[model samples]
Target: MEKKEAFLQQLSKENQKAQYHVMNLMESFRAINSTLELDEVLKKIMHFALNIVETAEAGYIQMYDESLNKLIIKTYVGFNENISHFKVNIGESITGKVFEDGCFRLITTRKEIYDSMSDLSKENFDFIDKAHHNNQKIKSILSVPVSFGAKRIGVMTFHCFDIEDGLSETDLLLLQSFASQAAIALHNAQLYTEVHKSLDEVTHLSQRLKETNALLEKRTYIHNHLTELSVQKKGLKAIIIEMNKLMDRNLVYADYLEGNYVPQHIKHFAKSLDDIFFLFTSKTKPAYVSICDTVQIDCYIYPIRSGSVLLGCLAVEGSSPLSQLDKLIIEQGAPILSLEIMKLRSQTEIMYKKTYETYHHFLKIKNPQQAEITAKELGIHHHYFLQTALIELDGNVDLHSLENDALLLLKHLKEKITLENSLLFSYNNKITLFSSARDAVSEAYITKIIESSIKWWNERFSVVARAGISTGHYYPGQAEENHLKAEKALLHLKKQKKKGILHYRDIGISRLFLQHPPEEINSFLRETFSLLWTGQEKKDDLLHTLFTYVQNNRSMTSTAKELHIHANTLYHRIKKIEDILDMDFSHFEDYLKVQLAVYLYKTFFGSLTKAGKLM
Candidate 1:
């Protein structure tokens, strides 16, 4: 009966200890895996390992360092600093052998512990022995492999020094189970680290993608807005206004042909370019124009062109550099602006063609009633008397270039004529202006309009032109008559080979000569200016002298002064002229005949000079 009781007590004590160990191990596992840090995991594993097992007096945990091919002691309890420096190769010591074999080891005696070490590791053992210095002599040892799979991680070891039955099967099993948990904890830490790193990368990429998508959406919006503006048929002025609003900056469209800007308010940008018309046509790219001299500004210039033909340029002004989005705005806006310009130009050409037809039709209509109806149709009422001014470009200019100039001049003149109540049209090499003369004083106003336009056109557009105005205002019945007077004045001004405004009243009896046929004019010029017709070397000089003498009203002293020559020199020139003409200038009839011939020759402006022989 006593033996049975003792056996029952022993069995019950074992069950209680096993339950304690299992409960302690479960708690330790929860603590061990709480963090992902390798170093912290090692500390918790060592702490919980010692706490869970009663037999273990001192303990250590080692991790495999593949580079050193060694099991390095990482954490310990009841050991000196010398243990940290203690390293073991595979199968070198008890710890190494357990790691290498992936099995548990039981060193029940000190001799077994010494024999478990290889000869190569004797120095390491001696060093550890010396550190102990006979303090708490080591008796029994238990070592277990820390492994997750087939791969060995490290070794966990415990010792019971000089205690009979202090370590047992339960201790070995518990230690082995703890070693497995340590391996699992280490691996979980590594996996946790990798997951967090991957998450950070994904988050960064997502932010960048979001920003990129936003920028793309903004670009699409700007492009569509520009396209819609063009589709709506808004003109250049509307484009500039919207561009200024969109960019929140100053923008202007430069019209090279017109030598002006669309919005006259900001036309000062004209000076920003030295010459964008020629400069931008060739570049065909966006560039910076430094306008630092006057306003301390840096404007971005995007050249607007139609193939090789430079229409103009679009200018954005700012002291700061343009953003990529702003530059994109310019790029998209430029093409739409080009289309608008081309549309306006096409519309302008069609309108000019229609106006030219109207001009010719009204000038040719002779019936008063029909003229009045046509004039009313053209917004020319009966209350307004009309005067005409004719502009004839140089005969040698390119017809295409001249036509372009005439279109540009028409716009320029229309601006000047706005308040003056005048209208104008351009033909092949001519631009004609007609002003509504409310009274006699308005004729001079009409002359002033043509003169100012000619002066401005010649200066700005590099076009040379001569203009002639009518001598009288005409109602609708005499529209043809007024146009003739202006035409005759221009022809006479052309024969003078001058650049200025000439009124028909100022041109003398040259109008009478124009009434004759071209052949008659040619015949008359050939016979009268006969020396000039024969290609005499002094023909030009003689003709110039005779014309000057005629202009001086046939006064010998005044002619001498006007010719910048001595009276004797004038006499000799007159004598030479008389010799060439086979006539004397002393008789009034002879002087009168010579004067008429001279005037006729000076005022003949027709095809009679195609040969370039006669004056």
Candidate 2:
């Protein structure tokens, strides 16, 4: 009777435990479904799963991570370790196998079900083996996959005390109910997470839009300031021109050529156009007025007129200094600047038209041959001159100055050459005058003219100058040749060597020889006639002495005189020269050949020896 009573008590206790767990699960499902808050729902689901199931130390409501493609522990209760941070792939563990198979699993130990293997045989058996190694001996473990609608998100796991008999079908049914409730809670949490993320992105976009608008507003403000400055610059120019007129009227007579009109006021006022507007409006002003120390500004004011009917005053300004040049620009630009304001039929012409007319006239030349005829009319021959010289000025060749210079050179050359045959024309950017040898002046006479011309050119203007002359006969084509020679002579003057006048005929033998130096001849001789000297090797020495003798002029007497020896002593040197060169010294033809060879050797080789030493 006692044994039977103990068995009945154990059965009743198990039945009551099952009823109590079911009651709590119903209550949790009711509470979670009522509260739409994902956090509260998940908390209640975990409590029911852990307390009602009365399983192992831990229980969780988890979901699958779509991005990582793994199961992630979401919320848990009764877990002392960080199981929420742990991960398992979809088909890799006992829970993963349940999710993959779309069914629940109840295993006491892997050894019991090894022969009844399913498609999850590999990982399921591996987990059972791992559990055995961990001293979870023959323990009953339950896994139920959670689903929301058609999506299986995760699994709910329950581990029980290791017992010989594993969990029954009834145990799996309770865990499946828990997994279903857990799925609903996890779905709500993910939706809430996505909504919060979208709100944060919207907030960031709004801030960026505000920053872009602020930048555009700043740019608009700066543009307005620049527009204001342009208006003020025009107003300032008018004021400056009006002041200049006033100063000109009040102090022009007293100051004579100089004026007491201080440019400081004008400069400061121009600077203020860029500086003052920022105070009037709260916008930062742009740097509109650029003042350089090396530059000068000038202004003019004139009344706009339509056939003498005056309109408002107009102001003109420029960067050039307030000189006659700026005055000329105004005399040229002012009327054109007023043409639109003026009446169409007004008698007053446009300044640009007048400027064009003036330049057109200046560039126009009439009767170029008149200068040559003027010389001929002065009783000088106009053609077939033996020799001529050309003179040209240096630095800043202004047309008006060159014209005046040509006229002056023609007058001076007439006095020197005393011939009416020369020609003076502005050609090759210089004042070129052609004078025959009869009309050719001395270098001193030419030098005096150049000095005077330079002084004249520098009056009220400062520039250095050089002049050059050519040595050649004057003809129609000789103008170009003379000009080139003058330029070459000018280049020579830049070296500070010879100056005043130069003639091509006056170029010394040294310069002529330098033109075709001996090295070129040496190269030719080495290429063409090298055998003539290379055989005995004495040919070089004999040539050297022969050149030395001819340079002293084939005179045995003077050659000996310079060599500091008797005539017979020098003859001994000369007689050996003919033998080594294999040429006759006595025959006139051979003498001429030897003379040419010596002349060529001396001219091309510079010195018979490389330096001026005897070989």
Candidate 3:
């Protein structure tokens, strides 16, 4: 009786020990697997297995890389560097034997007998032959398949130095089970690595695309501005030519003032405004315009008053109505051209402004120092101001207009705030205004002014404006930080259904959570709601009532008022929520589920109302 009791106790103890080891193994795996680095995790796993099993001399692990289409030697211990690079195909080595058989293979310690008998490569055989001849103690080894589900990912090999040491079949089976868990962990680690790499690449690509878009938008704006200037000049040239003909004073019909319209009196009016207009247009005919066949013989015309005109135009098919834009061009040109001609000065200011705009727009840069220097050289002093402003427009917002606003603010503020240096630029879809201030009080005042300016601009443009401002930059890098904070603040206000300006430090977490992220929350609710609704029939009415209640802010009184029923009746309808979900309303978990279901129903199924209600 005593012997039988002792055996029973021994069996129970072994079972308990096995369970404890399994749990420990699981815990260790979970702890190490939190790292996304695949190679480091695998090496640690192999080292753990080696320590736990207490293998002698050496341990090696091999993994199959699908990308390289090769079996790679990943981790090795107790091996010389010279032998570490050894490799073999899937069907080639003694290691390959277990992979093919899907079981463990054990080699006994009969060195002399096996050296001449083992089916190993000549190089490997020679090494074993030398060891055996030298009477070294490499006695036994084991190789086993590491698998998950049905797929074998790799093989684990261990060697023992003592002559009589070889693992039993039971030992091999236990190792195989551990190997399976290792396969799963390694697979997960690799997947995580790939996901993070893809995300990094995507982020890099998005930044590049944004930069390219900004450059393109800037160029378009410059092009439009240049076109407008040319049209204005053309209109003035026409008006001056007409006025000169009426005055008829020693009419020197300058070809530069009227392109390709040389009159028979060309020699007489060679030095006239008409000649100058023709020369300018002939010299700088825009790249877009192509000279189609001439429609008429040219006639010389001279300007009575003039400015720096871009091109000259003569009447082609008279008595036709001018386009609205053409009329606008002519109206703006008359006064400017007349002033320039009378003042006898080149319109260099306009030219300088156009060039500056083109250069900056063509090059959308984070650092505007180069542009600012060039502008200063051309007599346009730029100031820096730090502001975070949101631009709301049609889906196709005019990026060029936004950039122009930035430039105007920079120029205006530079003149207004002379004591402090200020700059304005755009980044990440927001206008950033950076500046230096004498004190915090001045900075706060500047922020208020900027907020008001943004609101005024938005109203003029018919769009919503949200802005945030930083205290003038404390330092260089601090400006960017302030800009980022301001952007975050704007985002916070947008989330909380608050419009206008917000300071970053003032945004609260509750406001952030309230922002309806219909995408993620809706998906979560849909999944949970579907799971709950799977085994129900009359629960649709309960779902509808719950959604309506939550939409009305979970007020039973309001729900009853809307439903034309007693508050108790509304309470009873909510009570039915627990019965349908097979959960008690008293439990926090059930209440959370009910709330989630209501949100999901509204977010996902609310749109079906357009097709005439959920029912």
TM-score of each: 0.50, 0.36, 0.32
- The order of the candidates by TM-score, greatest first, is 1, 2, 3
**lDDT by residue for model 1 (1-615), tens:** 999999999999999988998899999999998999878998999899888767788888888998999988888887777778788888877777788888788867776666666454666886566545356666788888888888888888887875745777878888878878889998787678779888988998999899889878977998888777778877677876777777756777777567667565243455655455546645777888765455566677787766654667777776578877777677778888878877877787788689779977987888999988887666676655678888877745457656655666676677767533555777777887766667877777667877987887666544578888885656776777877888888877766677878888887777776557767866766677776555655666676777778878879999788768899988898899888888788888878887877666655542223233343
Clashing pairs in 1: 139-161
Candidate No. with top TM-score: 1
Better of 2 and 3 by lDDT: 3
Off by over 4 Å in 1: 1-251, 255-294, 303-312, 319-333, 392-404, 418-422, 425-430, 471-473, 513-580, 587-593, 596-615
Which tens-of-lDDT digit does each residue in 11-79 have in candidate 2?
999999878877877887776676656677677777777765654555565577889988777676544
When 2 and 3 are scored with TM-score, the better candidate is: 2
lDDT of 3 by residue, 212-331 (tens): 787566445544544464556645344445434433232222332222342334332233333344343324331112222333223322132332233233222223344333333333
Per-candidate Cα lDDT values, in order, are 0.75, 0.51, 0.53
lDDT of the structure predicted as candidate 1: 0.75
Score candidate 3 by TM-score against the native.
Answer: 0.32
Q: What is the lDDT of residue 471 in candidate 1?
A: 52
